[model samples]
Target chain A: MTVGILFDMTKCIGCGACADACKEQNKLPGPVEEVTTAYTWTTVEAREGQYVRHLCMHCLVPTCASVCPVAALHKTPEGPVVYDADKCMGCRYCMMACPFDVPKYQWDRAIPIIGKCIMCTSRVKQGEATACATACPAEATVFGSRADMLKEAKERIRKEPDKYIDHVYGLKEAGGTGVLMISGVPFEKMGLKAKLTDEPPAMRTWQVLSNIPDFVAVWGVFLYGVHWITARRDTVAHHEAARKGPDTIDTTHTGRPS
Target chain B: MNSTATLPAGRFRLGFWTTVFALLTIPFLAITFLRFSKGLGAVTNLSDKFPWGLWIGFDLLCGVGLAAGAFTLTAVVHLFNLKRFEPIVRPTILTGFLGYIFVILALMFDLGQPWRIWHTIIYWNPHSVMFEVGWCVMLYTTVLSLEFAPVVLERFGFHAPVRMIHRLITPLVIAGVILSTLHQSSLGTLYLIVPSKLHPLWYSQLLPLFFYISAIGAGIGMVILESYMSKRAFGRHLEMDLLEPLARAMVVALGIYGLMRIQVIVRNGSYADVLNLTYEGKMFLLEFVLGVLLPVGLLAFRKLRTSPTWLVVGAFSAVLGFVVNRLNVSVTGMERASGIRYVPSVMEVIVSVTLIGIGMAAFALAVRYLKIFPEEKPAEEPEPEGS
Candidate 1:
């Protein structure tokens, strides 16, 4: 039921039509180019004479969404990870957390906010494809259910293993991104980020954070016990010295041995 | 050498350092004005490639790390009931309190909206590490104020409230230690999301542990260094008996941190990172050698531990190393993956310096007005004639 985009880099023609259509649809106010920016949410970068498109991977377990303190960014059931500006505190943690480095901030605004591809959730709800996919001339960008996208991608790779890289980018990266890609060249060579763990980054942080309650409980009990014993020893030694009074032996030392 | 002679003179000195603070702060304030009026791009050299810069690395990361002394010292004196270390509890709390104030100011300046910081309080995402950090920092700042309220009360001759606060200190110390441990370690958790971005040398599952241990050492080191400066500034006698034991504790903390760091590098097979001697590797060497190894080596010597001068040197080196360690994690370790070399603009450094000035100025003012360093009560001493 998860909607997604399947971008075939081999079919991309390096044209800037998708970029222009996105700007027109989103009403982004800035200079028009396929450059990476808060206004320009997508980039059709070139590598060795082939065109490769880059945008938000939109993970099933989104680290940007998980790390956001206000839950300003969240994954919708329809499959587009979206941002709510009304809830955003502008911490820029989402910028730091994105594995693909996709979230861009409007640094020049009076009040800044994160800007990234939303997978055109409004259009998809109305059964329309994303602007970039609709405007794509070469059939490079296809929109469908994630299951259909994965099935079609694997079939294409199987039919012509020599024609494609035989691996689908974003299939399991950061725990399987919603946007899938099949490229002729290796993903790393195409300036696509590589080596991300299949496990989501949020899971790593939680491994440490989940243990915190246990740590606090154990440490708290141990310290309290020590404080109690020290106070008791101090009380008893004070009375012992008082009974012996001023002219007693030189037991100058007292209280828990420093 | 009484307080009357030395205190005000040291504070109001119209000297080179004061002129420097003024010189830097004027431009610093001007840049700040530009930042708010225009935008972040107006004053900062930051780009999408480098979302964080000097503010996050130096002001936020290093500033918070340096302020660890307040909780560590408080726990030692109150929770552990080591009465010998009691003299340092107040000043360390003041330093920590002022340090957090500066961090908040810096964070506001760095935030794009700056006003919506309160959104974190109302909107709860308990899953976020930043959420934990946010709550802990706010709560701990309050704890610090309560811990230090007695000093302010004592200064104002409010004996009733002072007595009430004294009775409540046990719970206050417990809360402070817990909250500080939470945030101090969670600061490290902020970077755990960027495993692919952060270099392997700095990235580990044990980052939170490393952060907590190093911070404890940093806390002890700060107490040693600040206490030494306060001695000269206020003409107070050096409490060597207390400070020596404090230094010994720092040695153990630093030793543990250093061992763990070495183990992480060795187990990850990052030895080639050091052997290759690239820019990142060299920076790692500097942080590991000077920041961890050198300080631990110096303090481990029994002779060096006892000497005030040597202990100061060792602690200062450790503190310097700690600053580098944080910068290495937040900035240097991030350089390779970022594909852009980030050198902060002049205005960035100036704003940072201005914040430091404000922190120091506020600390000095507090020291002047409050009974932060109280003279010992004469009742405890046996009569001189009897002795």
Candidate 2:
């Protein structure tokens, strides 16, 4: 079963309990910052009088996993995209590719790896909710199977149309994220991108990359054909000069024809 | 007669340019030390908002694009069997080889976990554009090395190996061209994932095609500029006849690039953006005019194509334009979406300049010790009075 998180902005009270639990569970040091950084994985932003928690969307087909040269970042079966520090070369293509701008780098460290929320895959795999979800006192953040979460989000919006925006935030963004959100206010006002294509961004890169085999096959044959034709013509020209006379052959070697 | 008699003498002396290069290395070394010990934060303006900056844009993109002459010239001389253009082959290959080496060096500094660079080799990610580019670059550098091995072998009188390499030369050149075509275009494909993030004027589904075509133009322009500079430095003869055809080729490549660029812009329905004269629009116009229109106009005329001064001027303009285009795509195009302004730090600039200085020094040394240039037919010996 693919576990996921559903965050409801209307229910959140900006208590910062989830943020504290995240730091405690991850053993992250220092006080919680206003913004997400290498040390802070999640934050609650106060925007437009609504409390919005900012963290990794954990895309179904994560762009971070796709752009990595070394396959350091990958999606776990539990619905979280995880990172392997040992395999990471720190090219930062993932940071550049993530539409949500979730990934942060440890720029101050000589040897660094990317930092992002992994949706608490360890707890989810053991049939437990995420640290943030468990610590959420108001029940704003809930963890369940992706199907159940998406169903609840739709049900909530349908039952109280006036209380919601009539849409689920992550249902279609970046080809459907594992983390779902329903907000009374518009997503754009909460710092979420409203214009992201429903299709996965990785598919665009795949469109070009998939053509490599055909290109190699056709281009290889074409180059070889040109070489054969040129070599044959040069040979024929050489033989013709030889048949003409010794004088012509001498001049051909001494001077190139313009 | 001594073989050295035909060589250009006294040109490889330790002089003013060498001293300047040496002086520039001091700051680069200092910054490099700071970068490793104190970290990238101490030496660069890079942040999560601007993950990539001048190193990726100028060093990797511009360096690889300018080195395109190696594949282009190899195909022309070896595959096409254009024997008349053989004189410049060795030097062009040398420049291309050095270009790639320096690009890798620059990458080592840019990567945060550079020690794990070998993970790309062991790990496979066929879906990644970076994976494809990395493999192609590695294989192409090998192909280039083999293509150039014969020259080194000949100098040492290793006839067996030279003959073996000569037999393998045709296939080597073909492989080099294919590899180059893949990576040069793949570099542009890296930006394809950011359709929304990149500015509309620079973003297109056909980014790969644009990058490949512009690289061809820049490659030819680099060859022309290299020829002129070598003529000045080594006191060698300028092969105007060969360069004239190449100048025409540059015009055609840039012309096609310019037309396709306008077509893509129009088809994307962004023509209004072009007329609006916004910041992005202004940068796009500068890239188009400097890289395409100006160079194509200058080199289109026969008189200008034949004149060394005008030819070099046009070539320099084309090269400069190519640099601006890459920078626009990498930095300026993403700035609005990123909500951050990225300017290279002083240390970053020094590192780039130092890498270029190292390349030039390597090329000069290669020319001095190796048979880079064709022998100047020992200036027609004065006839004996009796004869």
Score candidate 1 by lDDT. Answer: 0.84
Q: What TM-score, computed on C-alpha atoms, does each candidate reach? A: 0.95, 0.95
lDDT of 2 by residue, B239-261 (tens): 78789999999999999999999
The lDDT per prediction is: 0.84, 0.88
Question: How high a TM-score does candidate 1 get?
Answer: 0.95
Worst 10 residues of 1 chain A by lDDT: A249-258
Provide the lowest-lDDT 10-residue window in model 1 chain B: B378-387
Candidate 2, residues A1-258, lDDT tens digits: the string is 778899999989999999888998888778888889878999999888789999999999999999999999999988899999889888899999999999999999988878888878788888999999999999899999989999999999999999999889998998999999999999999988867989999999999999999999899899989899888777766676778865666322222321
lDDT of 1 by residue, B1-387 (tens): 334411463446676766788788778878978998888888887878888888988888777778899989888777777676777888899999988888899988888787988888998887789888878878988998888888888777889988988998887888888888888889899999999999989999888888888989987898888888777655565667788888889989999899889999999987788999988789999888777788789888889888878888889988988988998998898888999898898888888888998888787778777777767443344222222
Candidate 2 CAPRI level: medium
For candidate 1, write residues A1-258 as lDDT tens digits. Answer: 788899998889988677888788888888665567899878788886688887888899999998899889999998899999998877788888889898888888777888998888899888889999999999898888889999989988999889899899889999999899998998899998999999999899888778889988987777678677766777776666668775643332236322
Instruction: Flag regions of model 2 displaced more than 4 Å.
Output: A248-258, B1-17, B378-387
